[model samples]
Target: MNINSIKIATVTAGYVAGVWVLCSIAVVIAPDTLRYISGAMMHLDLSQWDWEMGMDTFVVGLLAWSFFSWVTVWCIVTLYQYSLRSFS
Candidate 1:
């Protein structure tokens, strides 16, 4: 089966953006809980990690992460397509 790389990338990016917004909301609502969860997941102390939830920082991070996710997924799909052709 062939996959539409652009469509998949767009969808993945949108999903990531949605998740980012939700996480931002969570950070605003329960920062300490989020920090603890993150620390536990990474097995590192994030108590000293300062979180700057400025508007500018949030906007920039959202854009940068979405774009990064789009590019990464697009590349992966393209490579998968190439591998399928090579194997066939």
Candidate 2:
């Protein structure tokens, strides 16, 4: 991709990562909310449920996905630029 395309992709990935991080905060503060939404759509009580493998996993996954996406996009951009400079 060209520099412009890389810039756009990196910016979009960063924005998505920021949003994901923000939403992940809710899981830390209110783990039960995730259970209600994920376990069932009927607002089922999940206080008895384990947060380590369930809600915690979801939160960690989101944060990890966000970070990975942003990093990957940036890496692609760097590689593209390097290839251009090396080949030309």
Candidate 3:
């Protein structure tokens, strides 16, 4: 729609990605790193030797994935909108 809108879109995407990264790191180091805070260290008993992470880690990973997904969607949307405005 406009430069301001594009900027907002990028900022939103960046924020989401940033949060996703933080959460992902949390998941990787979680339960232990997350201990004494957002609940107990409930991962070691679960994901220690697992090929894939346990359910908890998987869920956090999903959240991280969503950020990337949303960023892509928003970027596309913003570009489409901008194109329509400039071309029309």
Candidate 4:
């Protein structure tokens, strides 16, 4: 089967936005948890971790993620189309 790249990109962008919203909410609610996780993952001191969240940050992240996701998905779709032709 074939797929529409634009539609897929829209869906991918929306998924990224949704994930960013959830992550922002999580950070807002339990910033300390995020700080601890970050510190553990990076082997850094929790005191050095700054878990900050705001509307401006969320909007900027959402926009960036949406654009990045759309472009990434578009590239994937293009590669898939190319591969299909190679196989045919």
Identify the leading candidate in terms of lDDT: 1
Model 2, range 1-88, lDDT digits (tens) per residue? 4586566666767788677666567667887777677668666667688666466776677667766777788777778888998999
The residue pairs found clashing in candidate 2 are none
lDDT of 3: 0.61
Clashing pairs in 3: 31-41
Q: Please name the candidate that would achieve the greatest TM-score relative to the true structure.
A: 1
| Tens digits of per-residue lDDT for model 3, 1-88 | 2445456655766676677567657756764444444434543343333334577766676666666666676778778787887889
Which ten contiguous residues of candidate 4 have the minimum total lDDT? Answer: 47-56
- Could you give candidate 4's per-residue lDDT for residues 68-87 as a string of tens digits? 99999999998998899899
The order by descending lDDT is 1, 4, 2, 3
Q: Return whichever of 2 and 4 wins on lDDT.
A: 4
Clashes of 2: 0
Worst 10 residues of 3 by lDDT: 42-51
All candidates' lDDT scores? 0.95, 0.72, 0.61, 0.88
TM-score of 1: 0.95
Steric clash pairs (candidate 4)? none
* Over 4 Å off, model 2: 1-3, 40-49, 53-64, 67-88
